[model samples]
Target: MILYPAIDLKDGKAVRLLRGDMDKATVFNDDPAAQALEFVAAGCEWLHLVDLNGAFAGEPVNAAAVEAILSQSKTPAQLGGGIRDMATIERWLDKGLARVILGTVAVENPALVREAAAAFPGKIAVGIDARDGRVATKGWAEVTDVDAVELAKSYEDAGVAAIIYTDINRDGAMQGPNIEATAALARAVTIPVIASGGVSSLKDLKDLRDCGAALNGAISGRALYDGALDLKEALKALAG
Candidate 1:
């Protein structure tokens, strides 16, 4: 499974938020582009970026920081947040984003997800952030009655490149991923599922890898920043 080092942007700085709480954000790096370079140097194949402010604002608030990272690194990156419309999707893709993950729109306007997937093929992905198995949107500010698995299955034929499943409750808590739920979601869908949130160690990575279901990859933020998960060691372990 691919390990995606996360660079969540809040006010143009790299930060990690606890349980999706914006008020509890802890800044990691002031120079996000430099952080991207550091991750690339550590042998990360892909980077995961989230525009924390943009997600709540419904517009690309950290565009400059994202562009800086893109310009500095050759590693292909996938980005989510503030990307709601076709024009915004097209703009980010043209600006060097390898993939565009549609989150809130996936629940509110699935037709757009279908249209974008049709238009961009493998460049589109669905991000399902959940609390208690119910999908959350608008940067986790609102929770919906949508079942994560059912929503994932709904996009089975949409040609979505992957489904990024994040369990918000465990996020940044260093508790480890919800392996059972993530694995089940992966099993229930033919489309690849990338696990996100609460990934705290190499063992966690191994568990996800050996979970008996095919996971596309996993995304981690706080663990890497706090030295809970050594990126170099984790990459070596995953490589094995």
Candidate 2:
């Protein structure tokens, strides 16, 4: 299991939103590139980035910040939010993104997900963010009736790299991840499932690891930023 330190970009600054609410953002750092490097120095193998502005606009809005991070960090990073079309996907990949995560497209336009996944195997992933176990789209602003597991299963044959399961209610709240729900969804799908949301402690990571069936990795943000979890220790534990 890889511990991805999240550098969520909001207005070109690293900020974390409470419950996925854009208006409720807390700025953690102004220099995202430096932040990315810090995470890499801390021994994190991969970085997770989200474009908050892009997710709402349905287009790339924080390219400069993302580029800065890419240019400075040696570790691979995966990005999501506002990456809806092939051109955007191509552009990001051309700019050196290791993997592009499709959330809205996976729900609104699945064919595009298939096309991108087919075009770039192991370079595209689906971000299934759920509120109340039902998937949400457009950055969690809109909730759909689709079950999170069903949505993940729909993309199994699409050849996506991984299914990023985020429990929106747990996100940025330091409440701990939805391990039971995430484990259940992972078991229900063939694709690798990465857990997100509310990962506040090392104990939480151990719990996810102990799930033992389909758990792949977990994403953490606020806990890391606030010093509640140590990146180096977590990485060592995961690697061991």
Candidate 3:
């Protein structure tokens, strides 16, 4: 399992939101590029970035911050938020994003996902953020009745690279990830599912590693920033 350190960009600063609430964010670093480099420095294999402003805007608003991270780090990165159309996908890929995650659009227009997957091959991933098993869209601002497992199943044959599954209620709360729910979703589909939301300690990471489902990896934010989870130690545990 690969360990992905998260850098959530809000207004050009790296911050972690409490349960997807923009108003409840805690800024971790003013220079996101330096923060990304720190992760790379810590031996992290991959970086997970989300454009918070972009997610709500329906377009990329943290372009400069993202560009800064890309310019500094050679480590492969996956980004989600505000990537809505073919043009945006093309642009991000051109900007050197290793993988572009299609979240909101995956729910609004699945055909675009198929088309983009066909075009990008392994460079495209689907982000399914759910609350109580229902998918949320528009930056987790709206909850839909669509079952998360069903949505993931629909993309199984679309040639998408992977699925990033975040349990909304657990995100940023540091309550630990919903392993049962996330693993159930993983078993329901063949796509590689990366667990997100609350990844708090070495135990949490190890639990996910031993969870039996074939998950891609896990994304940790607050725990890492709050010093609750040591990056180097967590990486070592996941690698084990």
Candidate 1 matches the true fold with a TM-score of: 0.99
Across residues 43-76, which tens digit of lDDT does each residue of candidate 2 receive?
8989999999999999989999999999888789
lDDT per model vs. reference: 0.96, 0.93, 0.94
Q: Candidate 3 on 1-240: residue-level lDDT in tens?
A: 877899999999999999999999999999999999989999999899999999999999999999999999999999999999999999999999999999999999999999999999999999999999999999999999999999999998999999999999999999999999999999999999999999998889888888999888999988989999999888876776
Give candidate 1 regions above 4 Å deviation: none
List the candidates' TM-scores in order: 0.99, 0.99, 0.99
* RMSD, every candidate, angstroms: 0.5, 0.7, 0.6
Model 2 whole-model lDDT (C-alpha atoms) = 0.93
Candidate 2 vs. true structure, TM-score: 0.99
Candidate 3 TM-score versus the reference: 0.99
